[model samples]
Target: MKKIINEMKVRLPSHSENEAVARTVVSAFSALIDPTVEELSDLRCAVSEAVTNCIVHAYRDLPEGEFGYIYISLRLYDNREITVEISDNGCGIEDIKRAREPFFTTSESDERCGMGFLVMESFTDRVSVKSKVGKGTSVLLRKIFSPHTSEEE
Candidate 1:
């Protein structure tokens, strides 16, 4: 088997648009891996949450003209592992530990459930976050793909 990596970038102005972009990117990658419908849905949801966090939380105060970019990289390794990395150049988290707590949202008015990180963690096999207060944030997610018996000869 061989490994391939593909990357795409999208500018996010708000949380709503992130969902659509996430769906599109995840669908494309899932197609490459030939994941089940359920798995594809899960991947989309997780990617959406990560992207939303960047738009809603990272660039919350930025002006309309100011935009945050999401870079997504998908890697398929020997048909055994699928790795996705989503990054953004925005306000970046000051404290990753506190932010990841379930229901711990910085925006009470927005009614954020704070479950984004939790959902991402639950859906993917591995989830990692790297950020600096003034720099940016990068989320790395990995999920191992096991070919179904039908897919194997």
Candidate 2:
């Protein structure tokens, strides 16, 4: 059986500022579960990558100054499992497998290192990516809390 403790959905323009917005929302939502500082940091970093990818890669087709929207959903389970889903309606990844490979970035001119997926995977217990060319991409992240850091006994 699955019990949901809390859930929230946030939508924002795919801009740099909103990246912080997503991270803040996730951090605040996570605070309720008393995650360790490391866990919190990892969560924030993963969120940053996901949001950045939406902003940088997803809306590449849009004319300059025109931006798309990013949807972020967060769910907290009774068992202290946190799930974050970030989606973009911008250009989708044509090669999900190659994209997930470390250092595989399309934005070389922007100095992108292409480690977004790798970082997300490292921080979260599980990460899933779904994308369709010209449709969009959705990233789902899951992390289970274990009391081990300073924030927890």
Candidate 3:
């Protein structure tokens, strides 16, 4: 089993501004392992998409004056593998398979491209989502860097 080098978890309100908080925390955690510029960029984008999904879809059903919480965790292993887990205690997806299809969105507005999961999958090596209609949703993302990456600057 690989030992964990470092790990962090944060819980924030399901608000749009917290999306930046997720990116900042994940990027800072990744910096310790010396990821390449491209890798870091991908990590940031993936995290942003995941967090945005939680903000937009998870707690969407809350009453006008209330909001749920979003939980994000970052774990780094000795083998240079990173795992990111984002979960929300809000209205969950009714269909997992259908939700993952590219361009599939339930929002009525056209502004939503319905590519959040696709974007997350493109940047991460693995993506998994679990949810129940009323329990909430959880997204897990994993990516391993090449063995030859340079040390942190």
Candidate 4:
């Protein structure tokens, strides 16, 4: 029985410092469902990747010292389901399909591994993306924890 428990929305600057803020907020929110340690870790890592992408890539074209915003929304369900939507208002991807491919970064620097979506997909139950070239991008990640059945076992 999936029912809405609560929902939270946060809007912060596209600064690196706020990445941890987003991750911590999701961790605390999901903790209400008593997720396993591994589940919490996976959720945090996935959120970190999504948020980091916004800070690093989303506003790369902004003029010096200019920064945009990163918006994150979290919804918790009675069935132990949590959906996180991370979005950015900045230059969007030109090729959504190719951008999702591993090691397909637009960055010229050697530091980028281009594994953001891969990490998100690997960690979450479902990963979705929406974007336009000049508008912005949104990545939605959903994770559902199984009902407790240890007593039956």
Clashing pairs counted in every model: 0, 0, 0, 0
Residues 48-112, model 2: lDDT tens digits: 99999999899988999999999999999988899999999989999999999999999966979
Residue pairs with backbone atoms closer than 3 Å in model 3 (clashes): none
Q: Is candidate 1 or 2 superior in TM-score?
A: 2
Best-fitting candidate, scored by lDDT: 2
lDDT for 71 (candidate 1): 75
lDDT of 1 at 129: 97
Question: How many clashing pairs in candidate 1?
Answer: 0
TM-score, ranked from best to worst:
2, 3, 4, 1
What does candidate 3's lDDT look like per residue over 1-153, in tens digits?
Answer: 999999998999988998998898998899888888889899899999988988788888788878889999889999999999999987899988889999999887537988988999999999999898889999999999767534545
Question: Which is superior by TM-score, 2 or 4?
Answer: 2
Error of 2 at 106 (Å): 0.5
lDDT of 1: 0.78
Tens digit of lDDT per residue, candidate 1, span 1-153? 566655445454555666686779678866765777777777788888888887788777788777767777777776567777888878889889999899889986787788999998988889999998877899998877657557443
lDDT of 3: 0.89
| lDDT against the true structure, each candidate | 0.78, 0.93, 0.89, 0.89
How well does candidate 1 score on lDDT at residue 63? 82
Off by over 4 Å in 2: 147-153
Kindly report which residue stretches of model 3 are placed more than 4 angstroms away from their true locations once superposed. 149-153
